[model samples]
Target: MNKKLLLICALISIAAAVGYYFSKGPERISVTQYKVAQGEVKASIANTRVGTVKACRRAYLAPAIGGNVAQLYVKEGDKVKSQQLLLKVWNDDLTAQLILHKAQIKANQATAKQFCEIAAGTERDSQRLSRLKKYDRIISEEQLDRAATKARADRAQCQAAQVAIEIARAKLEIVNTDIERTLVRAPFDGTVAEINAELGEYVTPSPPGIPTLPPIDLLDISCLYVSAPIDEVDAPQVKVGMSACVSLDAFAKKRCSGTVSRIAPYVLEKEKQARTVEVEVKLSDAKDLQELLPGYSADIEVLLASKEKALRVPTEAVLENNQVLLITADGVLEQRQFKPGLANWNFIEVLSGLKEGDALVLSVGREGVEPGAYVRVEE
Candidate 1:
């Protein structure tokens, strides 16, 4: 009886050991996977905002006449109108020279009048000579010749005086123009985008290259635009007149509305040695914020394509190259792959990798996640 009892105890111990071994089986990672089905993927590219705010305006605000910067009335942000005085260059020298020209013009006018009077007197005398010759009176032929010579000299003098007066007048006009140009004025009602010359700074018209005298760059921000680059593949999809929205880092919370103003008929040579096409978006005035200065950069959302009830999925749901890991009913992870389609900011259109009611990991960051892992599904 004792031997039989000992054998029974040993059998019980072996059974318990076997149960424990099965419970502690080989380690397996727990993860969630989705069955291959449909989903969505949004495609976008980062781009900078750029556009010409105004056309045919002065970018380099250079004067036709050069002079020292006497007064810089406007800085970078001052508002100005057409013909408004924006700055003033030194005009003392120009002013003094103009005064001299005015005097010269006056003297020339007087000289012209004097010659005219003398010519009039000579004409009267000539008339007398003609009457005397006609009547064959006691008028000497030598006296008639003297009158003719005097009249001829007087007429020539008058003509010369008139020419001199005109020259002086022209000189005065030129000097006055130079002095007026000294007061640089705004060509349009726009903000002073820049100020190249400082107070007491010497400015010149001729640029000598390198250290060359600079012209102030002013921007007319009455109308702003977003200049974005579409990828070569998507370039065909963009067209002029398409509506778009612009966002920027300067004003992240604000979104500006715009339309595709122009699409270049030709592709520009890649700047920075990369291939790119410049697309222009003209923003509506309603979207203009104080921050939207000329050359202000932004990200543009163009309506390339859209759908009402399109198939889509979270970007996290898809894996490499149409491949996804699907968890079967038995909680076993299975590999799946499929084609993809259009994607927005959050969701992507899965052409095939998933199905409805499928459980897929929301992120690749899931712990213990990989193919063949055992996963327990949760919300």
Candidate 2:
């Protein structure tokens, strides 16, 4: 009986030892670790926006007067200079009228000359008759009066003919102006973007109720800009002349430098959405702008602040209340509070309680990882 009792006591002791070992838990937990490094850190506001490449000058060219398109001097993609003739409407009728009026002016001028000659002869006759009547009374008073009256009438006819010449000239000028209206000219140096009307197509004036196609679309692409919308929260920090980096999805690797040109004074609101402000960015380098075209989907990063050679860590490494789980040299976790300065989405600048080459605990939510917990760094 004593031997059996001693065997039971030994078995209980062995079971208790096993329970105590299991209560101690696993020796170490696998955790991801990050090394603190000195690098460049930037605080920026980034947003993806659909942007349109706009020219400094754009126009839809149309004629003031409606007529059949007589001639087209340019097509789409043609470069043009200011005042260059682009299109001409039919001006046959105006040309004919101008010619007729010019002929009338010449004819009227000849009639005026003939009337002036007649008036001069009559005036000479009137003067001689007055002198003869005064010297010898050979001419009757009635005859002298009749000569004077005929001279005056001839002079009036000459004046009327001269006025008629002026009227004809004025009519010719009006027709010439109408003919000029039939021709369309470029207002500025630009490229022809679209040609809505072809030669011989009738173009009507853009009236209130009538829809008419523009004869040509002109765009001056020498200077380009982008119109992008920014969130209202970040709009205050953005100001004119702020440097920005722009990238297009079409050119994935290429980036263009730009400056903030304009910021809207009012916020733009969408249906059940956050308010945004429109901003305009002007491309700075002309060389970099050569390959960029209008209407590209672009994303921009507006640099707000930056620090060079800043001691930084992955932003995820920092936990709530500005505390970071730092790993000691002995592979133990220590929750340490840090003062962070300039930070971005990827990195946070550690202002205090961290050093370059220090190992930082990155995985925060893993089980059995707490203060004073032993951790094994994952390779």
lDDT of each: 0.70, 0.86
Per-residue C-alpha lDDT of model 1 across residues 1-379, encoded as one tens digit per residue: 9999999999999999999988977455545444334433335433432433333244557666777777777778777778777778878988899889999989999999999999989989988887879788688888898999999999999999999999998999998887887777777767776677887777777656545545566667665676777655567777788767677767756454677887777766566555556787776766464566665556777766555555666667766775666677777677777566776666676656566666666545777777777667654
TM-score of each: 0.74, 0.77
List the lowest-lDDT window of 10 residues for candidate 2: 45-54
**Sequence-dependent TM-score of model 1:** 0.74
Off-target runs (Cα >4 Å) in candidate 2 are 1-32, 115-166, 205-213, 254-256, 270-272, 316-323, 332-337, 362-374
All-Cα superposition RMSD per candidate: 4.8, 4.4
- Give candidate 1 misplaced runs (Cα > 4 Å): 1-45, 48-68, 131-153, 193-198, 204-208, 211-217, 227-238, 254-256, 262-279, 288-290, 293-297, 327-331, 351-359
lDDT digits (tens) for residues 1-379 of candidate 2? 9999999999999999999989976598899999999999998776635666678788888888998999999989999999999999999988999889988998999999999999999999999999998788678999999999999999999999999998998889899889889998999999999999977899866888876678888998888887878888888999888888787778766454788888888988873577888888888887768887766677777778899999999988888878888888888899888889988888999899888888888888899888899999999
Q: TM-score of model 2 relative to the true fold?
A: 0.77
